[model samples]
Target: MRDIQHIEIPGHTLSVRVDPGPEREGRPALWPSVGEYPIYDPFLYTTMTTDDERNHRFRAALAHLAPDRRILDIGTGQDLLWAREGVQAGARHAVAIEVIEDAFHKAAANLPALESPDRITLLLGESTRLRFAPRADVCVAEIIGSLAGAEGAAAVLADARTRLLEPGGLVIPHRAVTLAAAVRLSDLLPEQPVAFAEAALPYLRSIFGWHGSPFDVRLRVENPPADALLSEGAPIEVLDFNGDLQTQQRTTTHLAITRSGLVDGVLTWLNLWCLPDEEPLDALSMKTNWATIYLPLFDSPVPVETGDVLELTFAAALSDDRVHPDYQLQAVLRTADGQQRRGSLISPHHGGAFRSHSLYRDLFPAG
Candidate 1:
């Protein structure tokens, strides 16, 4: 056994283990473990969450499933459901596929029945690439976020459906709705806009950092259409985690201020994808892993008055090529007169196998 250690990745914090001494052949090196939290393990909390209250509800809903049913639980956390008092009430056999080794190790202990060689099979790998011959009658996954795109749920589900699920296999919470609204919360900024404005000229000579960036661009929810999932095309479909999307049009919305304050940033609320045949994906109104993707739309803080209106536009498209897929996100803000303010976002792709060797980099920003 090796001692645990901590290691930091560029954009993410992760935990790993390391061998203290002696050289070993064919053994891979380990890094420090990401950190732990009270009541639950943090790493498992992010990837395999089953002990939480929200997951308990998800388990209960799955209880309604009939016995002897073949179900594929993707990203299963410690095989928690198998032990749930209600689980055996419905599912006769459950298959759990996990990607993380730590969670799987813990799961191996937590789910003792796994050793029985009956009623359960735990595969140590990602569901996206699981090569299972069993066709699931129902594919269960809690991989969802408030904004639908948060945990790469679309990608996980799409993969399961194509490779692991039986034809017409039922998807739980068959529907999902993503909602967006405009809000004013300037108190969160590190420094007030006025001071930064005075320092911009001299600061230009210094190291580049995010400053004068739009902290909050107000938004007014203008009729979010009902879509089962985010997609590209005429009506905009469920955003395919595995596919590239092209922005066909760009539009803006101006929101009226009910309260007066400095505009700092924008917040996007995403919903979990739901398959109707199965239980609703944990409801956003209920327990959710909701998060806000902040876009500092403006470099300088803008004073917003009661009844004042600020316009915002979102332009996006998914790039082509499975060898490389780029999700393009561009945002801009302006006044009613069409005068543009200081907010824009051109996102870059990072992580995964292509990060180091991608031709898309040459094609991005489209020349």
Candidate 2:
């Protein structure tokens, strides 16, 4: 049986059903599965709010907004933090949009406490599909994903800028660059060993010609060992939120090997430029909600040495869902002795089939 609870918001009382199974740290799990995804995780929200670097950059960007300008906040989340910050920074009016119902209710509940509640309007819907008067002087969105634009920020911001914002309007996090570098896989492997029972069961199952299928999994690493770095981070893609949000991006960079090491895969991170000509928030060394992502190249580490040059071609294309993008990396390693090795890696492994879905074709026929 599920427990029912009512949450009070600005204009209505939200009824929430609580599942009675697992508990997270003695507190009932408040996150509910909604449609294709679960509601925003509270722990993740907490981590984001606690990220000093991210908050500081956002505040700096908001402070640059013109006084009395209209603001539109997309994916406001639960706290409505950025929208509230805009109002505090002199935005005359604000429109906050949230697609998740649970997050919307939380934002609604916090609306009444804002310094100027009457100046803000909360809308529950997808910003890309919602129409608004083209009068907003600024558009603020924090929909950046693990892969920077992986959350469909490109398409969403492109739609908003063209349809909602006035000419010369500002976009907080005006630009972003996705970066990658070759690294030792040993630097990211978990230290703990699998339990005896768990390890034995998996091995036994595999002995009967029932080996598990191979799949791609991205790992989030807080801090990679310094000695594991094989090459300097190279920019793979640059996104201009204020101008064009490219759905497809490709770049090639040559990285000189810094030291001899075993290369397992590449390390990816984001550098978010909150404002033009301002310092960016670096995900690699900063305390932020985002962690460095590890993209493995092989099941085992590939040996490498100093004085080698790695030519990497990185490409990312938005899927039919317009959210998660498929990524591919092609590598050609040439040694000082003229020997060369070539390999390639693709995320999602599922070829271009997802892009042909009928729903995406109907929604974005131009693609």
Candidate 3:
């Protein structure tokens, strides 16, 4: 690899490198194209064809359009398929907005000869807050993340709807469905058996009178679409899956423990994509740009019993590598004895050095 120095924040020097590409601003290009990690735009993370569900949703959103309908593509990447499809469905103009300078140029260069050069227009700006002289009849924004909370999708959609859309205009990616469930914490890592000695030994003496190691439950899910964003305190239900399914886009839900045992940690997973039909979404059938962002719910010793309800408040937000781009776990466990314990884990990052501060506080809170 060639050695290339780069700058992140303007007027500041940072140790970063640009991939093989034309230089932009003050630094070399980040990647040769847009599919690499540390990508400027999240949309580049996914292949256009694999997102059939969202593509279908976007197409359906424009099906009712009449000729000459003006549409705005918020967070539009190098691909202008939505605009082209919208035009084919009667939309007259497609205006695109992007924040990354490199992606902005890419979109301009790539979208010009798409369906019609005169029909598409690309601009550079923030999607969360944008201004346009000509209002749009339809707005298409695909700013979803691994958990429906990255890239400020909520703010961007809300702002675009309020400031840029015409009344009765439709938005693409019609609806996103989020589901949730309760499974034994141990079920998440069936491939790796945990050591009873290493996991259970330290919790013998605790304020909760926990005699054994706290058992951790894991909940795996798929990334969600922007339309069906998950929030803290959202209500959810555990639906039945045929065991043939592998991934899901679940929301905050309550888990009832069937046995009395120590409660330790939680693992969360996400899946994001659109399905054309009820083909049963799962890990085997889907490919995502983002990997699983797991957060441990607790690091202390706790206990639970049959019928104990773990109330969860799941939320997703935009973040960087410095911090997780989205959050997936928020739970409050209600024991059979009427005790309330926080179920959201604050352990260190996975495979990284474990930070004992939060775990220590959880295990032994200051009196």
Specify the highest-TM-score model's number: 2
Give the per-residue lDDT digits (tens) of candidate 3, residues 198-283.
21111211201221221121112222222211222222312111111112223556666656655554323233333233232332
TM-score of each: 0.57, 0.77, 0.57
> On residues 329-357, what C-alpha lDDT tens digit does candidate 2 reach at each position?
88888878888777677664122332132
- Candidate 1 residue-wise lDDT at 248: 29
**TM-score: which is higher, 1 or 2?**
2
- Whole-model lDDT, candidate 3? 0.45
Off by over 4 Å in 1: 1-53, 82-87, 113-117, 188-257, 273-289, 305-328, 336-338, 347-367
Instruction: Assess candidate 2 and give its TM-score to the true structure.
Output: 0.77
| Local lDDT at 103 for model 1 | 64
lDDT of 1 by residue, 1-367 (tens): 3233332334422222222443343222111111110112443366344335355545554666535677777656555453332246566666777666766777767776543336667778777667876777777765544334334455567667777877766555354444433332234222221111111112211111121221111111111222211111111124432233122224455545445556544545444333234444432233333333333445455655455554555543333322112223333434445454555544322222211211112111111
The weakest ten consecutive residues by lDDT in model 2 span 27-36
Task: Give the Cα-based TM-score of candidate 1 against the true structure.
Answer: 0.57
What are the candidates' C-alpha RMSDs? 13.6, 11.5, 13.9
